[model samples]
Target chain A: MDPLFEKGMTELNRPPTDRPFQAFEIVFWHVLDEMFEERLLPGDVLYETALSQELGLSRTPVREALSRLVAEGLLENPAGTRGYRVPDLSADDLQQVFQAREILESSAAALAAEHARKGDIGELEEIHRREILFSSQENRREYCRANVEFHFAVMRIGGNRYLERAFRPVFWRSQLYVNYLAEFHPLNGEELTAESGHNSPAEHAALIRAIARRAPKAAAKAAAEHLRSTTAYRILLDTERARHIFGGSSR
Target chain B: MDPLFEKGMTELNRPPTDRPFQAFEIVFWHVLDEMFEERLLPGDVLYETALSQELGLSRTPVREALSRLVAEGLLENPAGTRGYRVPDLSADDLQQVFQAREILESSAAALAAEHARKGDIGELEEIHRREILFSSQENRREYCRANVEFHFAVMRIGGNRYLERAFRPVFWRSQLYVNYLAEFHPLNGEELTAESGHNSPAEHAALIRAIARRAPKAAAKAAAEHLRSTTAYRILLDTERARHIFGGSSR
Candidate 1:
């Protein structure tokens, strides 16, 4: 059994106040965690039987989870193949992903500005604080998680369940791009300054301030600018580097 | 077997160049068609065993189709219940749906303005022509179908697969709102005039012209204005009427 799978299973087995987690959901989050943590790199193929055996479960739940991930655009089942692989997104795919993030997240941020309660602002500030802490400590993994949480917190504060739901899969796909960026361009502790242009904490703080001030247009602009800066097209323009980061060749 | 399911099965059995439709997919579309046609009203509960028996298939595919619809927000599985019910959307849900539609469809229209080829415009004009023909003939069903095709065509021309895919389920949920509007407020031939404010044809034409002129912002504004006119909050504000249309009571 894979050590990660065992660790996930132990976590899943812990009792919760709500209903128990389903088998496939456990598998789904486990796989997603692996991808985010870079244990499962782009282009790595996952066989249903191998995963089922590794997790000491039947193939049905594993297959279900794999199909769900594929449906969410996190994984792709190549034509005429049974195995699901982490998608090697092309430059165009990254462009579309970022464009979508800008549209959806900006709208959410604007709505959050309108609807955000004091508690909501507080929650956002807490996440932003963690983001800064993680960045200062150069804890890339935790910083990435906190960054993703900050965006989702904005979406939730928007008070539109439909928009929030639509944002989920797109956000996950963008995380793949984030992971690649972090891998190719590791940020040193000193490079976390706003002048470095990779300073997510400063950008996030601006978004938080806009929402807290109830400035819808400013909030929307800040969100869009943040995404545009983070997903700098110049990085994606290097076909060779993108190919290397996306695993030697585009699928 | 139900005649609708039989008709859908016949269509599924037809020869195609690419591939045969799966059983679950056939069920999915069949159910969606029934909903659009108002043959299956909101608040109706669908039982897997009953649907399988009606379609003369096993429970597996029916279950899969129902679950897919639930995940798509077209149907909801009530807590502690085995059946899936067509959602009886609240006024708030309608508001959120329209807001999302504005955000997504306007983005799509803007992108279409930038990316549309001559052939793409021609295709949209063709669909618009059908819409006008149907509206003039008072063929509400066909007009509705053509209307949906027009929006989807705009999305396709946007050249963003991610946006297009994300638009699907939200688009479907919004269709429920469209159906209810059509049911409650039948349009007379005279009412189809632009002065009557039920003039979808005119609004659609304005959107087409904007896209044809390659004016991205104009295209976006036209699309947003069209949705705003069609989903007038005055209509949704009548909670009692909305409840009656969604089926006697709110879910």
Candidate 2:
């Protein structure tokens, strides 16, 4: 049985958005949103027929959406099956992802510092402002969206198109996994609750200031630290989850 | 007409390898080998029927091989055509590729330093020795094959599957372009002819020593320097090529 359409999940039945997107685009974002919200956990099958019927659309769009998601690495087709499911990555896999991100994003930030024009800096500032704005809202999804935009703005400002393109899929897939983790196990729950929207903006401000000063090394360090801190929180969350599962004897 | 099959290329008509392999594998490697040797330059067309007929095989295997190459970013289907062509990337695009490679490969070397066992170091040494041996040989293709093996051994020793997977396509595509460039313009013609394979092995040895000592920072630094030096040579070659093309007025 599909976990998404399983019993007691009545809230997800809302009609697909009537926005001016093509049907495939609509379905793609809907599935992605569900994955972000952890409504679709690892092993939750995305059956095209079920999704199309639930969303009041034909199967073609849903199928195309699944294919795109699979290509994006957010979902995978199980062996001998047509349906897609959230990919299951091991701890080593997750660590490699973070390690790669640290290398790429830090370089990107440094390059951004070296190359960012006034317009680029201004754009990043605007994105950070929106990120801060969304963080205070009750909608976590909106905050996530703004966060993605902010980081991508930095990547674009870095002025390395190949780096940006290569980084995009990894960043998105990592976020999908990280967001799913954060759903139940808040990484640093107390700090998250206490700071709410404050710390991220402050961090972004520091990064922006470094870039504004054209201090390449400092900007790279700042970006790397930002990502490292996030990963640190994730590690803490993983530890906490394991402790719970093992009756506090693990670790 | 397929550039590979056109005029004066009688050497390619030799029977596909006698080694026990399927048809598709032979076609794939043949195309890849041609790309590595710069026999298929940028803008060279790869007509499926032509390649299939020339190789004395059906089009299905050739088509699959082309698709894989396209996925690997070696070939692209030109607009309004069924044939593929070597992609034409700008100077900026090539620079970005090298930048991304520097980030990924350097970090990979660092990780390998941290995690490489004695056995891993031994394997790398063996691969490096093979590279040295091939360097003395007149066959540039054999030297390249050994070079690829040596680098991939380091990636494997790094013990990061995600990084290795992400690095593979980028590395291959960059090699394709670099090899093409080197055909007409040796990156460092004088030094290359003077030292031949001697200098590269020494560089590899230094990297191996760092990893053997478990000096992650030193290993990463060495790896990055190696790539940076290679890129420096490439820049020189590009400048020389430009000077010739523009009657020495472009600079």
Candidate 3:
């Protein structure tokens, strides 16, 4: 029989422990929660020994878990080293990731429009509706979670397993930047207003409409531009934060 | 002291391994080679125990390596108990990857045009020149190798590691399909003729010119269109091949 857990698709009835997934998978997610949840930052070192001791697990599983994070591009392990850490991206790196995400995500959205089932469109409408709900209430965390799901939902509809699988890791790996940016970018009406003044929820609404109508070209354009707006503002935020935190001389 | 390598940079000397790299890393690449060079299908089983004995290593590294591949989307490990296998793509899955690549690569090319440095442009031109040599000489392997490098040359000049890193694995991963297509595509003059009908050489030259001129929009358009052309053509070829190999009933 095929293994239960495919990527991002939850496994409700999976056995407690299995060959491919070690206990470290669970333990690793807990540690990753600190990073993906934004309680950690790049440049933070992960002491394998310490984590192994704390979790009461062997070094092997801890090591394996860390390897998974490194593969996800969230952590960097150099030269078969004992300790691992996150990569601290500069403005250049941020631009790079955002630009890539913008283009790739847009393309995914467009393709999704071509193959989208009625149910797929319905799911996206629901996600967008809930996004608006979370946005008005200013629930940043919930907004972040929903935002990821919405994008992934688009990927799911796009019918490209290869692309979906590749892109999702990138999405997870980028949590640091995404989470940090979200701190200043709240989900409230005022925050959305200031942010969306450039493109606003209207752009996303347009995207949803395009998908609903199954217009590939329009959907693609909407998605790409939406991503571009977010990245462009992300660069500005990074610049402003750097100046505020590190001073002009540092920059 | 970074053990990880980067593109187009001269390597600082380090002691070579007495054996190969880690067993799992070696096996991962070996399997990836099948994806790239040998046409390992999407759902092909990659067994740890068998490969471990072959490599004269324990299953530990092999298992860890499989996890890394799973994260990369090349191999999927089902959630519960089972061995790891490279997952097959539905037509939708393949479409998503190329679509994403099309957008990102196009944008990168456009950006390369706008921001590519003189030296970087020179380097890309150099790579293109090599492609001419490989193409005319009828060395299929060399031509394909040169082709990948030439595209990478654009990415390098684009100066976005994040974009390059994200685009390449997914792009190369499609070699799984290309490898099969090449079986029918053959290295004959007909194949070469089909390939050469496009002024890719001229497009490369034009892209370099745009980069030198720092025309970002032009570069982006050229790059995006270039990818779309390739993706569309490849899909056509895939359809034709499926019809031929599996009979018309397959489609």
Candidate 4:
């Protein structure tokens, strides 16, 4: 294979232009969405040759998109080689990712809940309502988007840029689990009543209440508990599924 | 002038190879350290031409190191940029860095107080002793290093890999504060009459006792209070110093 094909991260040195940046960001965002959607996995290579041809752009823009994707933790270029590939999902990684997410994002949610914007709680309430509706209807795509929106909104309101920056990679890394969440619609608490049952509606409702009440401790606890019950464990269950869907990762 | 000097992130294609990766990493680590030392600053462009000449290698490894540095949050190659440069750090950036450190590392210190390793506590005791000696004699650099070691050891014993990683960059980004702590080092209990006094040796001793006694709450309080005092006026000092050291950023 070509050296660039072998190493995924090194390509970031290429000079970029403004016109290419718009296309690059647009493509990368789309690719990242696909990465989380489970359409892209760890080992499968993103072929610049094919993408440039398909996207009707030069390899420059496509490669630019690839670099940003790599930076975002959606892809990796292993030490010895180049060209980007999906980072393989692993059980340990899943746990670490969630553990970090639990520590950081939970605090973010708590802070957001406490220091939330005037209408933020109302907006989150709407998100919760929409997520539950989408999940009930088994609309995986919409649910995933809403799930991301809800959490991201909370992080923004968390009022701590460092926490947000530090936790970002882990959040992106957990997209594999998000893909799994989409498929199984895991334990949308409307039905069975087990500890693992993640009732999206109820969780969202509680989250809004916690935030509305200006409750950091409650918001933090609720966020951690919600993640612990729903997203965290669900990632564990989907370990093999990730390998099956995205192949294996070298890292 | 070059495209790599632009305002956002974009991917670049890299042809790579299977190499030891050690040389670049060693260099990269030093490069990052120098960045923290303020040897590198925002808008100071990376010269691929010059670095390759000095390293006596092709652009491959040099560019690769630069790419990873960008990923490490020390450098930025904005969209349409052909070069990498250290990111500008504002007071808000510095404050965010410290605030999250206050939350996360304090929690880690508290947690470490619960299940601290025997060797860890012993080592911490020695660290405090050194700080006492250093403060007595005023050994600035050694005291600063000891300060980092003490905090990092506490975080390590916390046994939370996730938290450890999250805490690292924050600590690193605040090295300037560590250096400045030398000037702020309070003499003793008498000097620490106010909240913002450094008396770090005493604080560290208290922290050790808390951890030794497995008092999580006390350990956290000690740790948080120590940093709160040590860095309390750092923001104001930095703002005042900004014009001289960072006139371009003195907005």
Candidate 5:
């Protein structure tokens, strides 16, 4: 077993006091987090029996959740096979995912600017503050979670449930990219932390300000720019890594 | 026993020389069409065994397809039960669905404007011309199908597979609204036909022109306006129906 999987298992073992999600949902998201963090790499076999036993869950819900992931195209459903494998994320797939964010998140921000109440705006500010604090502490996971929370808050502020639902799978898959950076990139953990520490907070603050001012076009532009910045950073890192490997020009 | 279900059955019964979709996929989309057309309204039970028997398919594939739809939130899985139910589309649900269209389709149009090839432009023109011809013939179904095809063609032209995938379920659900107008609205078929004949072709022509000119902003704006126009028409019909029901001044 990979050490990353062991760390995930340890985290899963620590019971949450609140426990809002169902058993199946808990395992479902845990496995997804593993995949996002690159703890579960492409072609990593997910054994149903081991996962169920380890999570203290029954086999049925575990199978059900895996089936859902398989349908979402994140995991491959090998015919007549008992286990699932993580599907490889190609460059084209990553590009399309971010392109979708440019469209969906920009629209979401514009709607948020138009429709967000004072309370909604306050919630975004609160999340931004939490993100800032987390960045200072170098708590990557909590910072990432706070970022997701801020985006979802904006999704609700948009006042469109269908937009929320339609954009959701795309958003979760995009989160994988952030986790990919935090875990798999050639940069050390400290460098990764320092990179997000320097970049994410300012972008988030600008996003909140745009929403607060009710500037729909500005909000939309801010949201798209924020996503593009992350993509740009990741691509730059990938290019650097490639240059290091192949002895070629950075471009 | 419903007439709409019978029509869906006939369509599904026809043997195909070039069957591109799997049996499960065929059944999944067929059921969606039935739901959108109101052949399977709220509270209608979807029995896997009966569906399998009627469609000349096995239980396993039908079950798998229903599971997929259930995940998509079109079907409510009854606890401790074998079948599914169609959920009612609330007014809020309808509003959100169209709002999603405004975001997604606009983004798709912008991308299409940026990336569309000459062949893509020609294909869109071909669809537009066909739509014009269909409007003159007052063939509602063909016209609606062609409009869907045109939009999907633009999605393909956008060159973002994830965007295409994200837009798909929403697009399918949006088609439900068009079919809802045909089936359940107060207007007769002739009136609906007349309405689309007057409105849709002009909007579609404008959209084609924007894309052909490679004007991303114009294309996005046009696509969003076209969707809002449809929503406006539907809301007008709904208001009229409400007035007829409650004996009050139309709000």
Candidate 6:
């Protein structure tokens, strides 16, 4: 069993009434956290029995959590496979994921610009503020979390629950690639410099400004350009660097 | 009990080994078919126990089917509510769904233009051919299904499973509206004539031609324009007509 499972066992063993969380929700977040932290790498196979036994829980909730993760595209049960594995996204997969993100998030930004309230703008600003702080302090994990929060906040401001729901899985799948990028090219490293076309913080600021000003076209353009730059950065990494980031898990 | 439940019970009674279908999958399709056929109208609630009893199956599969439908946005388990209800989409909801469809399907068209092989183009042409046939024959349900197949074929040709997955639920939700529109305005009626701007068969042909010629920009523009025209036709349906179509179920 992976050591990461042990890390969350104490919390999982708590009395049911002690917290409002369900067994499957607890397990889901635990595994998701492990993936985001890189403690669970791509190609890591997660067996239901092993996970349930490690957590001292029944196989039911364990299965539910794994199945949900698989449905969300964060994990995959390959054809004829039993256990779920953290997906080893290839370059083509990365391209497709980014392309989907560009479409969804740009439209989300446009909607946010048209529909966002003052309170919504404040919420977005707060998330972006924390994102900048996390970047400045070199907190990679929190930075990733805050970055995700910023995009999700914009989605919420879009005032379309369906759009937000559709964006959720695609956003999380792309985050896996973002997390990998963060691991190889640190937050403040030279690779993310303006010349590398990966200046997300600055790009995020521009997006927020457009939304705050209620400029729908500008917001959409800003969001698309930001994603395009990110895609360009990913492409520039080259196959050799991608191999390093994926840790020999590229399929 | 809904009479539609009785319609599929005969098929559901087959022995487990007779077919490879799961109980939950059968239930899922049965419910989905009812929704698409408009036998299950907006604001109709579906309970697990009731569905299980009607289908002569256990609550487990019934619950699974309903939950999957809820997750897919076909049905909604409203907050503080117990059973799933066919969603009562408002005009804003319709707008949001169309916006999402435009973004996803247009991108899918562009990607298909770039990546589609001859076989994929042939597949799309076949679906469009059926769509026109059904349209001329005044077959609403088959026309709708072929229309869906046409778009899905484009998504498949895009070579991005992720994009197709993201588009599925949104497309289905939009189909509900399309079905409602069809109920109020027949396929060959004046409301869908050239002046009313609801010419799907012609638009589909244009999209296919663009894809066949490998014109990515033209394909994307055709897709976007097609959805925009559909949205326009939806808006043209006054609130009174919408109420009649939804059977006073609009929320």
DockQ of 2: 0.27
Regions more than 4 Å wrong, model 2: A1-34, A45-72, A75-85, A186-198, A235-251, B1-34, B45-72, B75-85, B186-198, B235-238, B243-251
Summarize candidate 5's per-residue lDDT along A159-189 as a digit string, tens digits.
Answer: 8777777677777676665555444556645
For each candidate, give the TM-score of chain B: 0.83, 0.79, 0.78, 0.75, 0.81, 0.82
Report the Cα RMSD per candidate.
Answer: 4.6, 7.9, 6.5, 8.6, 6.1, 5.9
- Looking at candidate 5, what is the lDDT of residue A190? 47
Window of ten residues with lowest summed lDDT in model 6 chain A: A7-16
- What TM-score does model 3 achieve against the real structure? 0.79
Where does candidate 1 chain A have its weakest 10-residue lDDT segment? A188-197
Select the stronger candidate by DockQ from 2 and 6: 6
Report the C-alpha lDDT of model 4 over A1-251, residue by residue, as the tens digit.
12321222122223344453366655665566555545665567777788778767787667766765665566777765666777655566667667678888778877797678888877887888888887777765566567767777788788887787777667666656555444443343444222233375687678778888888888888888777766546646666653443335422
Clashes by residue pair, model 5 = none
- Which candidate wins on DockQ? 1
- Candidate 4 per-residue lDDT, tens place, B1-251, comes to 12321211110011233553355554565465555444565557777778777667776556657766676566678765677766665556666767788788778887798878889888898888877776666665556557767878788888766677667666666664333332333432334322234377788888899999999999888888777766434433556654344323212
Model 3 local distance difference test score: 0.63
Rate residue B84 of model 4 by lDDT: 79
- Candidate 1 lDDT over A81-147, as tens digits, reads 6789888756788889889989999999999999999999999999889888888887765676677
lDDT of 6 by residue, B1-251 (tens): 24544343222222235345667767987887777667887888899999999889998778767777777888887555788988885666777788788888998899999998999888988888888887888776566567667777788898887888898888878877766655554343655632223278899999999999999999999999888787334554455555445444533
lDDT of each: 0.74, 0.67, 0.63, 0.64, 0.70, 0.73
Candidate 5 residue spans exceeding 4 A from truth: A1-27, A43-63, A76-85, A187-195, A231-251, B1-23, B47-60, B78-83, B231-233, B236-251
The superposed Cα distance between candidate 4 and the true structure at residue B110, in angstroms, equals: 2.9
**TM-scores of all predicted structures:** 0.86, 0.75, 0.79, 0.71, 0.81, 0.83
The CAPRI-style docking tier of model 3 reads acceptable
In model 2, the clashing pairs are none
Task: Check candidate 6 and list the clashing pairs.
Answer: none
- How do the residues B1-251 of candidate 1 rate in per-residue lDDT, one tens digit apiece? 24554432123222243555567766887888777667777678889999898888888778767766776778888555778887775678888888898999999999999999999989998988988898788775567667777888899899987888788878778776666665554241323221124377789899999999999999999999888777434456556666555444232
